[model samples]
Target: MRQAHRFGSATIWQRNYYDHIIRNERSLQPMRHYITHNSLTWADGQLHPCNPSKW
Candidate 1:
């Protein structure tokens, strides 16, 4: 976005992002949980390079 252009760095924005319509509340709850908690597990995930065990 504009911040990435202004900073001359897009380390986070370099990844693809997407948006979707929430047709029902039932579907939104899971996405809400994931959005709130996903980052707590990121460092331990295989896709990420910084595993806490290595520290």
Candidate 2:
């Protein structure tokens, strides 16, 4: 999911993820928050009958 968003395409061929370093804790916390909150944030998309809970 993260790869698809960052690279603008899925990496399903590899069946894995790539990572990059975060500069510091200051940069890291909000990213954690977003990841943690993502399910709620995108719930409407999941709720749509055709979308099928991308999470």
Compute each candidate's TM-score over C-alphas: 0.44, 0.39
Candidate 2 per-residue lDDT over residues 7-55, each given as its tens digit: 8885445556557578999989988987888866674675555567554
Winning model by TM-score: 1
**lDDT measured at residue 1 in model 2 versus the true structure, 0 to 100:** 68
Clashes by residue pair, model 1: none
**Model 1: how far is 52 from its true place, Å?**
10
Error in Å for residue 8 of model 1: 26
The positional error of residue 39 in candidate 1, measured at the CA in angstroms, is 1.3
lDDT to native, each model: 0.75, 0.71
The alpha-carbon deviation from the true structure for residue 26 of candidate 2, after best TM-score superposition, in angstroms, is: 0.3
For candidate 2, the lDDT comes to 0.71
